[model samples]
Target: MNLSVVIPAYRSERWVGRAIRSALAEGVADRNVIVVEDGVLDGTAQVVQATGARLTSLQRNGGAPHARNLGLAQVDTDYVMFLDADDYVENGLLAGLVGALERERADVAIGPWVYDGDGRERGMLRQPPALDNAERIFHWVMHAFFPPCCIAWRADAIRAIGGWDERLRKDQDGELVIRALIRDLKVAVSEQGNGVYWQHDSPHRVTKAQIKDVMYAADVVFAQLEGWVRSRIANGSAGDERVSLGRFCCKTAWVAYAYGDSAAGAKWSAKARELGFHNRGYNYRSALLASVLGIRISSRIKASTRLVYRRIAQR
Candidate 1:
């Protein structure tokens, strides 16, 4: 199958070459490697041009979604895959994903990915079995899956859903895939690991520094999900599937507290309570403390506990 790979790059001169090389190594021709440079001329454009990949340089930084949409508009192949500039896919990843899609006649095919950085394997993000229904896909989204790098899509299928949400600065992949699943498209999952997502701890990375933007995106995603669930319930198509809004809210609350946004944390925890989510797991203690002492005080207590534990350990 003819496949086109899109890599959205910004200040990625250091690793964008490797990403392009990885795609080319998968037997994808140079003409099919499209790199959308998001207005950062940090020598990334030079590297991409040197590799002979088709380069589309935007006038200014428009974030990943914009770059991806721009790249999507340029796709002319049967299948398409996205690779972040800092990450590289394993050999044959494109062929593996395309083969799975063709064999299953699926609109999308996904494979497992490993999270690694600084020359060490951190862990794996495994794709669940083939999801055929909206409810199952919704459940998967509530848990925050990895990025879109692990999947390949039938180019037309993605266009049918209007591509990614350009307004979202984060969680764009989850939002896009969730809409596709809600539209009742078929999905095939390959258990074979094929992708690598580099985890960067640098504060410059959006994932590391954009907590507020991420939380805002989360709210939009969950709101859409809640609407979908309501629609499913109204149509009587929701089977044994339960909407895990409470769990989602609790998780969001924890994230807010961890990011030092106590007001947001308390608000989300209250929302979870309203949704009938009983904090029954590791969140139980923190939930209770946040409820009684407010998230700010509760967070302080937790921080002190961690500090004390570390001091004791060093003794």
Candidate 2:
């Protein structure tokens, strides 16, 4: 199967070469491994050139989604994959994902990924539940995440959905894939392959920033999801997605609290209550704690605990 892997590099001269090498090691032809340098002259293009991979340099920095869309425009292969410049794939992972798409006749195939940080292995990311398409999408909207490197897409199917949303600097992959799935794109799970997602403690990294800004970014994504769920409910096409959404809101409230956003935490928790999702054990425990400590104090406690854990992990 013809496949193209697009690696977007932005000020990643130190790591882009390794990413390129990993893609090449996947048995993909050097010519088919394209690197789009996202308007950074930080020797990233030079690194790409050194690997003999096709390099497309942008004149201005336009974030990852824009770079990915530009890369998508150049794809002439039947299937395409996106690899962040800091992350890499295991050997044969690309081929395996493509094979899954072909064998399952799917528009998209997602695989598992392992976390690598500070030159040590962390753990495998949790995979989404095994469910039919509709149920799976609901679960995905609720919580699960598949990083961009673990996903391969039928080129045409991605193009049909207008590529990635360039407006989003983070959560672009999740937003794009969820949008595609909501459009009824056939998706398959590739259980045999996995990729490496490098975790960084640096706040400058986009992934780290995603966590810091989770309240805002998550609300944006969840708004879209909630609208879709409401529409489905109105049309009598939804099952228990309403309850799932309420549970999702409750979960997000915890995240907000952990991130030190008490106002947002209370907002989402209230939304969950509005949706009649207060009977769960965790919810009951959280409510008891909040009643005793107040939301702001509760958020401070959660944030402090997270900070301590992060420092310990960093050590």
Predicted structure with the largest TM-score when compared to the true one: 2
Per-residue lDDT for 1-315 in model 1, tens only? 489999999888888999999889888889899999998668998999999999998879998989998999999999999889988887567788888888989898888777777635467566556546664564665544756678899999999988988888777777788777777778887776578888654554556547788788878877776777678779998653332767777777766776788788878878777777766222568768867886567766786787685455444
RMSD to true structure for each model, in Å = 4.0, 2.8
lDDT of each: 0.78, 0.78
User: Which digits, one per residue and each the tens of the lDDT, describe model 2 over residues 1-315?
Assistant: 488899888888988888888878878788888899888668898788888999999888888888888898889999999999888888567888898899999999888788776635488565544567667765675546778878899999999988988777667777787788678899888776578888766454776655445666667667777887888889999887777777878777777766666678778888887877773213565567777886556656766887787677767
Show pairs that collide, candidate 2. Answer: none
- TM-score per candidate, chains pooled: 0.86, 0.88
Per candidate, the number of residue pairs that clash is: 0, 0
